[model samples]
Target: MAPSTTLYPRATLKKIVKAHSNRPLTKNVDILVFLNYTLFLQELMKEASIKSKQSGERGISARSVRRVREHCLRKFKG
Candidate 1:
């Protein structure tokens, strides 16, 4: 199973689901379309990584970028 879905509170999750109910992620659909294209996620993630690196942010790491990119790609392709 997936991690506990408590990432968001029950109410907030409900709102998010109900609000985008029409465009909800289908069982077989990749979640990239939850916004638009998967590449957008890749680019944004890269940009955030660059920003954190420049700012000397301590916690963020390059592995996060690769993980997010791969997750998005896999979700979209499969």
Candidate 2:
């Protein structure tokens, strides 16, 4: 039989739900899905940026990282 699938990986969805558990209820499932996608992209960008700095290659700008960080903080803050 095929393994069961979820909208997101179990751990990722748990982390997302746990992170937002104390926040206001303005966000719905659709918004949560978007947040998950954005957060994943942000993490990828951050890692790439870090690797680029280490390898002496230009990745995303520091300002862009800062903006994403702040946006995440705002979204997840209780």
Candidate 3:
């Protein structure tokens, strides 16, 4: 088990995994998947916010998110 930051509920995460997977996930795999998802979202949003600022936007917009999305994914792939 991970230290429970609990950004999202465990049951919700498990449901998502179940919906996609052919086999059941282990408890640790569930936590790891959820953690990675949250981290990716966090990084994506952070990059989008910065992109918005650079373009003189007041806040993150869909366009800003779209622009920075590939860059954020590349960071994760490394």
Best by TM-score: 3
Return whichever of 1 and 3 wins on TM-score: 3
Worst 10 residues of 1 by lDDT: 26-35
Q: Which tens-of-lDDT digit does each residue in 1-78 have in candidate 3?
A: 678776667788788878888787787777788668789999999989999999999999999999999988887763
Score candidate 2 by TM-score against the native: 0.39
What is candidate 1's lDDT per residue for 7-44, written digit by digit as tens?
33545544566576667554423342343454666665
State the C-alpha lDDT per candidate. Answer: 0.57, 0.62, 0.86
> Model 2: C-alpha RMSD to truth?
7.4
Clashes of each: 0, 0, 0
Point out the worst 10-residue segment of candidate 2 by lDDT. 22-31
**CA-only RMSD, every prediction:** 9.3, 7.4, 5.2
Alpha-carbon deviation at 2 in model 1, angstroms: 8.7
TM-score of each: 0.32, 0.39, 0.65
For candidate 3, the per-residue lDDT at 47 reads: 89
User: What clash pairs does model 3 have?
Assistant: none
**Model 3 residue 66 CA deviation in Å:** 0.2
